[model samples]
Target: MASTAGIITPEWELPAGVQARLTTRAGGISQAPYDGFNLATHVGDNRTSVLANRRSLLRQLVGVRSVQWLTQVHSNWVVQAYGGAVVPVADAATTEQRGLACAVLTADCLPVLFCRDDGRQVAAAHAGWRGLADGILLHTLQQFPDPKRVLVYLAPCIGPSAFEVGPEVKAAFGWASGDCFIAGAGDRWLGNLQRLAAEQLLASGVRSISANTDCTVMNSERYFSYRRDGDSGRQASLIWIES
Candidate 1:
């Protein structure tokens, strides 16, 4: 596994040769707001800085041959990322080929990582409210031969205490009240993206699940939160198998 300054390494006991890491807002040359380690090219950051940050991140992963980046559209589309090319217009990606890593960029939105128990396959997803409601997780899980053998890691996201949503957002999930949703002022609600993901994964028969409790909105020093700071950088959650 790779380690950048303050990079969050998932604590799950993954199968041998399956490695994953969640990047934080630490380590890099991007300017203020993007400040230290901004890995995204969009959002008005300089291309040079973004590229340099990405290169710095890649250097930490010892055996990773290539990383398949994605132009996320907050949709349920899942693509097979076998080559080095970035999967365009997709929010989720999976791969069976070794040495090719799959990654998703996010700032407050949930980034989910998936791996099969045998370490032959891995996937990554960018699931905001819209993608989550539209079943991006399900779409990613369907790529695996057996969903039951899949293990999931829900990376950092906006917690329920900080993620305020309207009634339509709650209605989209077809739920009025649950542990994942908390009623707020008037018709507003606070939604837990992590819990919602875990519930959906459980319902799909996936038994091994690990999640980080870090709330991006609450932890501005360690993470980048879109809701808290508009026009911010995006961190990444990546997963891959060894060659």
Candidate 2:
């Protein structure tokens, strides 16, 4: 529930030992387009700048021992994370170890953070439309003991008004997705990514949910949106059990 210059601490009533933060596109040294606080290493930002930004983020994390970063393939795959140099090729990561942070990178795609009510475990998922419809959140939740005992935080993403998609995109979620999409231009639908995510979480028995409703596409000063700008940098959402 706290916000600093470039970091947003999600407003969820997690256990005392669980901590989470999402980075905004501010307070970094990268140049235009990539601009400030871009965290993705594969997004064409300068190597040195990206490394420096990561170090700055680590410093802000206080006692975090290490952060597990994923390759994020837009798939439903979830992996057990241990903070180390080897990056796994998965969309979501979970960890029960204290001081080890799990993180996901995104621009317009949704980033969902999860933590158990008892503060024993934490997870992060990169939930782009492809991954979300494929059940990335559910896969991540499977790493926990029970869905009902987990709290979820949906990060800022491209909002409904800006997320126009073809009918085939809506078909991915089947009949339940119908309410999450509104008619857009001819043959197009304005999809509600957050709503879809929330509905899915609810269906999975997760009742404790909160979100950052800021639209990445609309809020140019605070976020990076791939749909708004073709080539863009990425922000990160991270969760961990504090030591």
Candidate 3:
């Protein structure tokens, strides 16, 4: 794990040469509610600031490949990421092309990262319950040949206890053969986003896995959470090739 300092952000290189990094709330420039380093343009944030923040990140990672961002729709559609014209309505993005980075933005939704040990390929998926239940993880896994060659990392999001859901959410996963949920407060249920993702990754053949201890709801000072804030900023979790 590399320190996300001085604009390089936190870049983590697995034994296989695959590298990743997650942005912090401390960097960049945005306003209140979206203050500090907020990175989403669709969340009612100032476009100028969002662009500047993105520019700052690009400047910091100069000489490396440009970051390939996606327009996510909380769906299960995964697309090949080659710095080409980004497809509309895609929820997950993957890449075998180096230099160009793969990134996903989220406030409360899970930002899942995937990579083959050889470091030749990497991917990022934005998975809210809607996408997760739709088999986004499973779909993303199809891009990689060996699940064991892949590694998984979950980003900050609403915690299970904080993630309250209705029958639809439960039934969606239930129909997918997922058994990670349990009954909870009122008519709601507690869904473990990390566990569900982990099981799905393992089911897809991932041999190595790690889940972030960070929770967007709990670590508001460190990340942005939509569940905690009715409308708030977004944090980006990304992976790129090392120059």
Candidate 4:
């Protein structure tokens, strides 16, 4: 229930010794456009600025040992976060080891966090439209011991009212007549990614679910949105096991 420097701690009823944080576009030293706390290094921000922002964030995380960031190619690949410090090119990461962090960077994409009910494991995934439709969350769930015992948190992202997509996107999920989409202009439709994610999680036997209802595209002052602003810094959503 702690909120500081635009960082949002997960509001879920999780197990003890597990921690999660979602950073907003505040509290960092990045300049215009990326004005607040931009933690991403690949979004045209100065390397020094990005490093400093990261340092500022890491400082607040009192006992977190290390964070494992991924390349995030928008695919369904999931990897273990305990494989040293080399950042892997994957969409999701999981870890059973204590002190290791599983992290994901996103501007408009969903940052989903997972932790076992027993507090023995944690994971994070970058779930954009492609990744979600391609089964990124499913892949992440496979890494856990049991889907029923895992708690999931869907971090902020583009909301249904602001996320209009082409027919292909809707067709990808095979939901010809579901609440996940609403008819839009011509061949386009307003899609609800969060609802789709929830449905997917339910189909995969995941029962415990929580979500951040904030919309990145709608909340310009608090979040960064790649869909709203073409060139923007990405926010980070991370989860870790306490040592």
Top-lDDT candidate index: 2
lDDT for predicted candidate 1 compared with the true structure: 0.88
Per-residue lDDT of candidate 4, residues 9-54 (tens digit): 8788878888899999988899977877998888889889998998
In candidate 3, stretches whose alpha carbon ends up further than 4 angstroms from where it belongs are 1-13, 84-87, 175-179
**Candidate-wise lDDT, in order:** 0.88, 0.91, 0.78, 0.89
Cα error, residue 180 of model 1, in Å, equals: 1.4
Task: Write candidate 3's Cα lDDT for 1-243 as tens digits.
Answer: 444542223334464445677876777779888877877888888999998998877666644467777889888899877776554468788888767778899888999888888787888999998899889988998889887888788877788778888877887876344456778868778888888888777777788887775678988777888788787888788876564
Better of 2 and 4 by TM-score: 2
What digit string (tens of lDDT, one per residue) describes model 1 on residues 1-243?
Answer: 344486777887799998899988987899988877888888788989999998888888756888888888889999989665445779999998888889999999999999999988999999999999999999999999999999999988998899999989998888423888898999999998998888888988999998888899999888988899998999989998977
| TM-score quality measure for candidate 2 | 0.98
Clash totals for all models, in order?
A: 0, 0, 5, 0
In candidate 4, position 63 carries an lDDT of: 57
TM-score of 4: 0.97
**All candidates' TM-scores?**
0.96, 0.98, 0.90, 0.97
- Give the least accurate 10-residue stretch of model 4, judged by summed lDDT: 79-88
